[model samples]
Target: MKEIPEFQTERLFLRGITLEDTSSYQKHFVDYEVVRYLADHVPWPYPENGIEEFLKEYILPNQAMSLWMWGIFLKEKPTEVIGAIELCRKGKPENRGFWLGRKFWGKGLMTEAVAPITDYAFTKLGFEKLIFANAVGNIGSRRVKEKSGAKLIGTEPAKFVDPKFTEHELWELTKEDWSKP
Candidate 1:
């Protein structure tokens, strides 16, 4: 298995997910506020073992292959995964997806977490461009992509845990446009 390297930002650390993170993952991720923004495929009444099942089935197996995921942690609370970010080689319309705990929202933490991952995608993974999407009214997520210089492409019908979100916005960022620091 290709080990996802551990890295850090000014206020956060990023590392691979583990079964041991199940408790913190469930605590932060199972809330309706968080899950509501996700693709409709995520069960609304999250299963009791959702975190464990996801780690084993979706995240762990693909972590070293077609997908890469990182458990986002605060510098102070290094052990708790407050959020997650992922990149996939194949675009199911978009190559990136992410979520931050509601308590930690509006602090630009997700934006901070996205930087190194985007760098890893273009530089390490050799992606020429990346596609991103979010439910149409999800301004927070859209802002992260916009702040990183991604252009708004268009919108398309999409399903989300929040049924009111009937469409999603698409954005694109090419290697030539990525401003790496």
Candidate 2:
């Protein structure tokens, strides 16, 4: 398995997700505001064992499968997780996803964290393209993808833990386009 490296952005630090992060993860993730638009796999009520099971059954076991997950922390408070991001090589339509605590929503923190990971996706992992999809109403997420230079390819029905099914705008970024000045 490829070693996951830590990343530092101007205002945030991105590191591997750890079991110790469970409490922090729960603090931010259990909020309906945060998980409403996320994938359907995210438990609606967010069971107590959610993060633990994710770390053990999914993340830890999938390192060799090219799945990378990160805990986003502010540089000033490096030990606290304010959000999370993941880049996976599993399925189609979308391979990248993230969510920030409601408190940090409009600060462009997610955008900052995205750049290095996107570069790593192409330059380190050798992925030819990266895909992202967000609920049609998730303007913040859409803006992140737009800022990252991902182009709108189409729209499709998507399932979310909160709303179940909704239309999502799909976006794509190619390594060639992302590498350009």
Candidate 3:
């Protein structure tokens, strides 16, 4: 089993998820604005049971060379959960996903949150590439990927099943690209 690694940024700490994050998960997952572009498998108003199921079944088991889901916390208030970020491996490459409470949006927190995880996945997990996709209209997310040094790999239509109709845009970054800055 891979142990939880705490990654520090100037103002935040990226740490492993705990049962205590249920409220944070509930807060964001239930929001329509947040889930509108998320994959079909993520249930709306996510079930209480599902939270525990994710931690035990998917997250805990895949930590070694695969999935790593983390709780984003403010450095001064380490116990409080601001949001969640996940680095999931597909074959040998990892992809990114994240959610921030509505209040945290437009604050550059996601950009801060993603960098260290990308670093850890490439530098520590030995992954050479990372990718992230978004509903084509989601310019905010695209900007985050661009700011993280990921290049636009063009859009893929209907690539993800959205309960509400939406198109997805795929983006990618490699270790060589990230190591530049």
Going through the candidates in the order shown, the clash numbers are 0, 0, 0
| Reference-based lDDT, residue 29, model 2 | 84
Best-to-worst order by lDDT is 1, 2, 3
- For residues 1-181, write the lDDT of model 1, one tens digit per residue: 3589888999999999888889999999999999999999999899999889989988998886899999999999999999999899999989999998899999989888998999889889999999999999999999898888899999999999999999999999998777643
Cα RMSD (Å) per model? 1.1, 1.9, 2.5
lDDT of candidate 3 over 44-156, digit per residue (tens): 66666886787777777887556788899889988778888888767322277888777778988888888888888898887788877887777778888888788878765
Position 15, candidate 1: lDDT: 96
Residue range with the least summed lDDT across 10 consecutive positions in model 3: 156-165
- Estimate candidate 2's alpha-carbon lDDT, on a 0 to 1 scale: 0.84
Where does candidate 2 stray beyond 4 Å? Answer: 179-181
For candidate 1, the TM-score is 0.97
Q: Write the per-residue lDDT of candidate 2 for residues 100-164, one digit (tens) a residue.
A: 99999898899888888888889888899988899888899998988878899998888787685
TM-score of candidate 2 on Cα atoms, chains taken together = 0.93
> What's the CA error at residue 150 for candidate 3, in Å?
0.9
Among residues 3 or more apart in sequence or in different chains, the pairs in candidate 3 whose N, CA or C atoms overlap within 3 Å are none
Q: Which is superior by TM-score, 1 or 3?
A: 1
Leading candidate by lDDT: 1
